[model samples]
Target: MGKQIQLQDAAYILKAGWKLFSRRTSLETLQKDKQYREFIRHNEAAGRNNVSDEGKRVYAVATDEGVLFFSDSGKGMKTRNSYLQHLADSFFNFSKGVETLKLYEMEIPSRQVMELADNSIDKLAKSDLRNAGTQLRKSEFSFTKEKMAGKEMLEGAVCTDKYDLRPDYNNFDRLTKEFNLGISPRNYDVASLLYISENGYAGHVVADYFHPFSYEYEFRDLAEKLDDSIKARQSAPMSLHDFGYAALQMEAKVMARDILQSEFHITDGEFRLSGKANRTSQRTKTPEKCLFQQSKEPEPEKSGCQAAKHVSSVVPQKKEKKQLII
Candidate 1:
């Protein structure tokens, strides 16, 4: 059983909708700040109901146990469905580095629930965060707005508690086979693949969805196979947080590859091979070897007057503490 403990890590907000945006605070700052903790507790309790539907934002708080998500649209299960949809949507967006997937249209079947469980297990195996169980709650809609003619509205909140599930499965084919998700060509696999690529090959497979382009299929297939091969024998499953971290990593890799190819003549053939070799050599260096290998001359020491002047020029003033509008 996972226990709820103070979220002592760095805090960040990842918002999804028309666009994706993230806000972050240092671990030291977030943990020491009384107001921030209060704000999270308040929002977890009543903030979803207090805010209007139009003003409702879909976001996640990366926590010690798992991602804490808030969704207030209707009571009980409805609220859980909404939150789960947004959760998948957020994962898709993070994986692809864009908000283009039609998340509402995608189905969240029993298989997906299994996927989520498997992914969570994998995450727990790789880290200490999930040792504490997660909290989930759902409630009836407390506030209402003028109904738009005949459109129905949902209300409530659901917080689902998850224990640190033992990640004993690592085979994607075997695990996926355990769930009978009647196949229909859907982009959910695209989202998951994008997730795997961004995060690294956790025990997940690319869905057998139709791809409009040959190159897209090739790219995604290669990634899928490669990831599967790498984790074929691993025991502990990947962590859920790795998906978040992996997305950022994938973003960086894509950005770097594009920049390198576009700015420098570093694409394909010769330059790419040379660059790969260069990187390989760099990775092989030990700290002691690297220190001795460097041949740059030391700069002349600065006088007391120069040092004092430099210090005076670079010193920074204190910043005022910020207030929250909660």
Candidate 2:
């Protein structure tokens, strides 16, 4: 079996696939294309429409290059939905084979994040803190029960609201007050938002301007639950926003699979590259091993019979027909 691709590498592959596919097509073209329109029509007939009351639509097209998906809400509220479009733009840029820093790789200027946390804490009235503490204690009881049952203790396990421990706002405030004491900005890592779709396909994006909560040791489980909640809303009769997000998640999986299949055979979620695919990639990169390259040394002449044998070995010969005995 081929070595399993790390999630980071998989993200790159998916990004490249989307860029290539998007270059070959656009959202407008896809909306007008017969195949995509037909797909939407079929879905509508099946009582799963992608159109929203606001005239926004989310759709996908299957092209030879790969599947291209789009969440198009025309020109009016473009600014409001620009975040979604920015993700597509980022995918295209990342696929340009340039050295672009990914979200997690970028050094975040944590001053803004710290300030934001501090301001939020300062705005919380004493009554608000008491209410928040009451909520956390209520949530903690259920979370503790789930933890005792060996469910919510894992690092990255998805837990519902009933099973998740609400962030202790009071603790968060205490930590913020002591932030300058020993906590360096470097102490925090950017949290990644992981999503598992309704179809059981998983994808993740690194948070751009956010870090883990000051009081939280790890935020993976929280991010996962947030993702799960978002995905849970992406169902039949979904809003335009939800439909678009769902389409993007589904498209990512499709593009990833397409890329993997070109280089590797997938079986039961395992990937294995065939010998021919591996050799072809290697030969293309190594000039001396290229099939089109000619040998530098002259070949020795062969006898006519030997030449004939060589030709027979390389080329297929017609089979002789046997005479039928009546």
Candidate 3:
């Protein structure tokens, strides 16, 4: 049986995990720091307003042991729902280790979480800081308000029947079969359904009353099929896109293992992978090899002083820590 932990504990675990995995120093800390806030405001004034969401945010962590831990920033249900669906799709398609998804709505505000992250990042060495900027640019996946506004909504036929009574068993069957779980789809409670349209656009159906149901129940598209071949025991050559996605998944799994071992101190058996785990630890350790290749020739390496000067010019220097009035 999976162990249950308190939301506060989950938050702490997530904070530690983020500090380890994310190139961003700390979301909450940077947001609260007066100087950083001013810097962001200045950037916004200059029409570069791609700042992180100030509203309640949600953080999700999934493991191979079929356990998922979620910590909500408390207020943004609509935004949270969208993000949850995205996460669900990511786990279902890319991450095969995950079995069960769980949520723990946090009591603390999102700002506090960012502050915690800021404090953690402040302790890092200058070398780590230098690497952080580059790593962040490589892995950052942002969801700007404009992008969210342009997101395609589900316009398929809406089902008046309750989720349990719904006639279409295609999606549910596919989900169960993919996971290889013993339970029926009726017993499998999901937060949402992510579907790929016949035309190839991706959309989600929240598991609510009057949810949209697509007739094209096939979840795995051509790209996904190509990606899955990379995960098979007998690996095949992958396209650049497929290889990059696979590398990212591998990196995330390594980070997840590290987080679980360090924070939870659980045995390997407790957090073991569900499928035949890929043995690519060496590749993951060398990020240069894991990163996608660029068509253009790489820029020459800069000297230490020149690199520092460039970094200073871009990132605002941190001032003395002061409490931010939220």
Candidate 1 lDDT, 1-326, residue by residue in tens: 75332442323222112112222354455556565664465446354566434343332222112232223212222333333333333331212221111111111212222222212111112122222212222222211112111101101212112111111011121212322212112223332332333233322233223423222453554455544533542332453223233343354336434533343323321123334521111111111111111134533312101110101111111123111100
Model 2 residue 204 CA deviation in Å = 4.4
Scored against the true structure, residue 247 in model 3 reaches a CA lDDT of 41
Whichever of 1 and 3 has more lDDT, that candidate is 3
Q: Report the alpha-carbon TM-score of model 3 versus the true structure.
A: 0.19
Which sequence of candidate numbers ranks them by TM-score, best first?
Answer: 1, 3, 2
Q: Who wins the lDDT comparison?
A: 3
What TM-score would you give candidate 2 relative to the actual structure? 0.15
Candidate 2, residue 257: Cα displacement in angstroms equals 1.4
**Candidate 2 structure quality by residue, lDDT tens digits, 1-326:** 74454343344336435442353345555556564564454444345355323232322211112212222212111211222222222221212221111111001212222121111111223443244121111111111111111111121211111100011112112223322112222222111101111122222222223333232223344445546646655453344445344444454335434533443242122223552321111001111111111233423312111100101111101223211110
In order, candidate lDDTs are 0.27, 0.26, 0.29
Q: How does each model score on TM-score?
A: 0.20, 0.15, 0.19
RMSD of candidate 2 to the true fold? 32.4
Model 3 lDDT at residue 126? 41
Model 3 regions more than 4 Å off:
1-75, 91-97, 109-326
Question: Candidate 3 lDDT, tens digit per residue, 1-326?
Answer: 75454443345436445442233435555456564553444334345346353333233222223212122211122223333344334432222333332232222324434332221111324443244121222222333232221101111111111111111123333333433323322222221221111112122222223433332143334335433534552253333334444343343335434533343232232322443332221111111111112243544323111100101111111223221110
Cα error, candidate 2, residue 296 (Å)? 60
